[model samples]
Target: MEVKKKLLDLVRDKIRFKHYSYSTERTYIHWIKHYILFHHKKHPIEMGKIEIELYLTKLATNDRVAPTTQNQAFSALLFLYKEVLGLDISEWNIQALRAQERKHIPVVLTKEEVREVLQNIPSEYSLLVHLMYGCGLRMSEALNLRVKDIDFGFDKIYVWDSKSLKDRTIPLPQKLKAKLLEQVESVKLLHKQDLKDGYGNVFIPYALEKKYPRSKLEAKWQYLFPMKSISTDPRTKEKRRHHVMAQTLGRNIKVASQKANLNKRVTSHIFRHSYATHLLQAGIDLRSIQELLGHKSVETTMIYTHVVSEMNKAKVISPLDF
Candidate 1:
């Protein structure tokens, strides 16, 4: 209970500042728990650099954890000692965990294969995939889209508090406008149900809830892809509306991919990768693609250029060159 209470309070304060997500809070709590257990239940306050180093060493050697995971654990511990506990543990060092080089090429479906996959999905899942492919949205961003975010008048969709917690808008598809209208109607029904249950308030970041307390109940502010059921807020522990889980969408996709007889390991990301590659192949400028994808750097967009179909069409290839 001591370890749990200490961490829960620290994480709650961290969340109160609006500095991280519920997922980050959960991950930090987990690492702290593991760190404590590594010391035979000794409090980290009484612990020192040597104990932390031994734990990190175990994660690298005995656990053989992946490099990314090792880095995460390192970061969580760093935050705990310096930020949470106010301890100067900066002098402490551990052997860096070796990381496998991440492969650069994202899996991309061929142009025709994309159509085949699209043809096979059910209506709801198909729409989700379409937005991901058409707008270059992350699956979560597509699922989390609010009704007000769509701007048919301006032909743009606003993405708020995304990966970097930055707001950006990109053009809306004229093709999908009718589908958005139908989707909004469904969201209205879900909004009514939440109102009936006295749980109309949907989660919003920091001051937005105070600015518009009833906004969650309003049709305009409802999620474009509302979850099938209401959810309890992690911070307040009150039932509120949330968007459909990406896992639900993923399962639906998995079933459809099997039905479609797709041999390539299919995922929601495949659609996003196809979006970039297809746009590049169609001769859209890289800077334009960068904006659509919400990438901070042009470097991320450059990966799609590596796909075979992006090669110069005018180049003459000789069979003898190989």
Candidate 2:
């Protein structure tokens, strides 16, 4: 029991050392625990490529986990072996039965449908929805937005260390300027109150906290969309004002979709999909769209082309019409 506890502690230490997000740290810990329990709590140092392959194969064959989920599990184990345990995994070529990957078109809301849903969304999340669709931002990107990231003078919004681990800028939506400024002013006031009450520090990303020691207390470092109440930092256990939880926005989106009377399923990501599809429909070139969406490959951006083609099919003259 002591050995198992120490092993997980090492993984957590390494993860924090690398400055991974709290959510990522949690995911890695969960997968690592499951992997150990799957092997009857054998220490990972005693295992190698064959044990890794067997566990992954069981997930696909017996548990039937999705491809992405299986891949996440593989990543956790790989991190444990390489980073935490100081093992070289360069030649571990053991192949496991891979989960079958299925490609499906993402659900997108039409411009009118998007407007209807936005109208139904509670005022609290309205600005967030607008930004998500206007900038084609992922939910995390939107939620994690910092005051410094919004470049009002330059008319750009900087996205730092996104899912691709790359930074990119988006054109600030002209329609949202007033609301955004208002939100900034509101944050400034709230941050003042928090500081006066002796709890105003925000969570700084990566190694910035160590480098710029005073940044945590700066207004510019605060989350753009903060929660109504202060919450304790999961890692530091410090009382800090973090951003609104993803689940809060997620549940409200479901309720807003129902109120809007939309026939299709609605999700936060659907707004992003709609943003890409609408741009394609508006004659925006795929290459430019790829840059705006921060896609690593044009091939990934090409999915929007397929979506547009499917929509265009409805305009074709049928045999009866001819």
- For 1-322, candidate 1 gives per-residue lDDT tens digits of 7766876587568656755777788888788889888888887789887787788778878888877787788788887877777876777655454545466678788878888888888886777788877888888889889889988789899998788556789788778889987887778877887788787777776577788786656788877887777787777797877887878888887777788788988898888888888888898999988888888889878888877444554366787886
Model 1 per-residue lDDT at 91: 77
**In model 2, which regions exceed 4 Å deviation?**
none
Clashing residue pairs for model 1: 155-172
TM-score of each: 0.87, 0.97
Candidate 2, residues 83-198: lDDT per residue as tens digits?
A: 99888675688699999999988888889999999999899889988899999999999999999999999999999989887799999999999899999999999999999999
The per-residue C-alpha lDDT of model 2 at residue 156 equals: 96
lDDT of 1 at 83: 78
Q: What is the model-wide C-alpha lDDT for candidate 1?
A: 0.79
| Model 2, residue pairs in steric clash | none
- Scored by lDDT, model 2 comes in at 0.92
